[model samples]
Target chain A: MAIPDNQGGKRAADVIVTALEARITSGELENDKPLPPERDLMEEFGTSRTVVREAISSLANRGLIELRPRFRPIVRKPDYGTLLSATGTIVRYLLNEPGGVQNLYQSRVFIERGLVRDAALNATKENISDLKAALLANEKALDHSEEFFRTDIAFHGVLYRIGNNPIFPAMHEGFTSWLSPNWARMTRSDDHNRSVYLDHKAIYDAILERDPARAEEALIAHLSAAWSYVEETF
Target chain B: MAIPDNQGGKRAADVIVTALEARITSGELENDKPLPPERDLMEEFGTSRTVVREAISSLANRGLIELRPRFRPIVRKPDYGTLLSATGTIVRYLLNEPGGVQNLYQSRVFIERGLVRDAALNATKENISDLKAALLANEKALDHSEEFFRTDIAFHGVLYRIGNNPIFPAMHEGFTSWLSPNWARMTRSDDHNRSVYLDHKAIYDAILERDPARAEEALIAHLSAAWSYVEETF
Candidate 1:
């Protein structure tokens, strides 16, 4: 493959990235293979070690390659870390920039409605048991209160697991972490904890009963109640 | 701020990144302020120029800092590109791994349903006109064919504009591009074109009528039809 010479506004690393990107997407660099070593890449590209390293780092940052220090970089299946970071950053953007925290929370409602719908449609005996286990944990931990939050997050995560999609779990965790601190500040009352547990129990019962519409209804009610709390507190 | 010592597998760059991450997240490094110059950072961190640069790049990758060559790094608002890179990477992961393509399409359906519902509820005359302009352009450009796809994608993007949140558009564009090649193969027939146009028209009319439930119904129908075609073909 032909590698282009660096041009205006293009760093040497950028040029290497363009060349590597083409090779990777064109199937020349097989996913099973490691990239050429830094010394070889430096010699081949006639660039400094730092330039070659940066080029590889750029590819890694974009989730195109996996890098381990002192090892040849491996061609990688893009992973969830990229998704998690990106999602957390976007939530921060909505909170700090013009979109307001309400927009972020509303988006979460849309996503959870989809998740619970999928869980209800796809839930098996094992999935139901998993949901019950999480809820049972939540019920037992309420005395600890701090532990209430952990089980609550895990219950929603279990819903994603029933749907058998990695994407949902990644997104659920990201959205939950982003909203957690604000949610804690807004809903610290005893009444809030009781209702939160009851709302989750409703979601659990609906999923166990194999009713997607009911599950969505319970989730929407839960979100609506939470939204009211946030709006009122803020 | 106390900069932690580099230990175990942690490189000097990693040490600097940890220090910077703390200061940035704590708001000690104000968003309006650029980081200290490379020479200053190098002196402070007792690391090489390459290490300092890499640390800065790490912060930039996380959207904590913005890097411009020939300038000190500026603190930045986390932006859509980070989210886009993450999401596109995750989609790539699904395509390459046992995760399969179904997850990506299902995720898109979930997201679009939300976007269209928002568009219907929040749309104004300007938003409606934008949707109409895109639809009209699609109708007029059927012969160009490739332009047909562009307009189709643009039409959905316009829907996100009505919701007044930047996240949906970024996601729609990313997901559309990822699915474009597969969608092209599935819907190359003239029958596909006519139906696709009609489906979009249904969506536009629903939004113009300010009926969100109807808008969602049209979108779900459109997606189900498209999903069936993909499933049958691939």
Candidate 2:
């Protein structure tokens, strides 16, 4: 492979990163396989070992390769989980900024509003049944705060799953994980859990009735109440 | 500061990273100041130079600090730009995957739907004027496709800015940057630009009239039409 020369102020390492990234993303490098050994890359790119290592490190940072001690970096095909995981550190940092928590919470409310409306309009029979099962699980776990939180997320997961787009579920998971620090600080009780469960029930019932407006209203009410708990801790 | 022991199978570098990250995030380490010299960190952490360097690299990857070629790493207080920039690589990778573009587009639509509604319901007079300014600039740029695109994004940006939340504007910018590749590939003409400008005008008109439902409907219509153009290149 011909390595593009550094031009227009692009560094050698950047050129190598772009080239290798293209190959990896195009599946030419193949998943789970080791990238070219460091020496070979140096030889092919006509660069020093340092440049090759720099390129490899950059690629690893981009989630294109897995770097392990004493092992060659392995190619990783991009997946939804990897994509979302890449945002974790950034999200954590943002969560600490002023109004960060409220902004993120509002974003979630906006997103889930769309998801629930989509569920009401387009969910399959299996989707509704899955939501019902999740609601039941949530009801059963009401006395257990930790379990209640888990099932609460699972119930919301169904709304995401209804879209059959992997991005939605991954995004939902990201939101839950990122906002969880705040969630953890909130005082939980059976009464609080019961109120949340009732909100879910109302949302689910509206979805079952195919009433998008009502489903959206219930979702907003639920998230708004939940935000109040988080706000108290803040 | 006492360094935590590696009792939980955490690497030496990880422990150092965690310790330094806490210092930086907690503002113990001031932004724009160089972190302690390598020798100092090595002594303080009771680790080798390699471990200190490793920890520094990890911190840089998480965007907590900047590492120049010869200078000690400078502390960087987290900002919205840094947070969103970190998602750029992952978003690019996902845009290459099946249905990725469409999924991201749908997300933008969902987000903008909420934004336009918010603009309609809550926009102050100044917000309305800013949007009208953006709309007028967009009209003038219609004959220049590239300029028109910029003004188009600027118009949409007003919707994001209405909420006075940094996160929304950051998100809007992220979506534009991430999706611009697809938009670039679409055919553009004065006629096409005119249609998009009209859509923006409709959205602006609804916001000016304080009609949330109409604004939302216009937004959905506009975004749906825009998606068809992007979908064609698929």
Report RMSD for candidate 2.
4.9
Encode model 2's per-residue lDDT on A89-207: one tens digit a residue. 66776788778899889888988987888788888999999999999999999899889989999999888888777878877877887787798978788889899999999999999
Best by TM-score: 2
- Give every collision pair in model 2: none
User: Tens-digit lDDT track for model 1 on A119-216?
Assistant: 78787789889999999998887766678888878888887777676677777776777777677777456667788899999998898787987998
Best by lDDT: 2
Error of 2 at A69 (Å): 6.4
lDDT of 1 at A199: 95
Off by over 4 Å in 2: A1-20, A32-57, A67-74, B1-9, B33-48, B67-74
- Itemize residue pairs with steric clashes in candidate 1: none
lDDT by residue for model 1 (B16-38), tens: 98888767766788875999888
- TM-scores, chain A, per candidate: 0.76, 0.89
lDDT of 2 by residue, B99-156 (tens): 8888888878878987888788889999999999999999999999889988999999
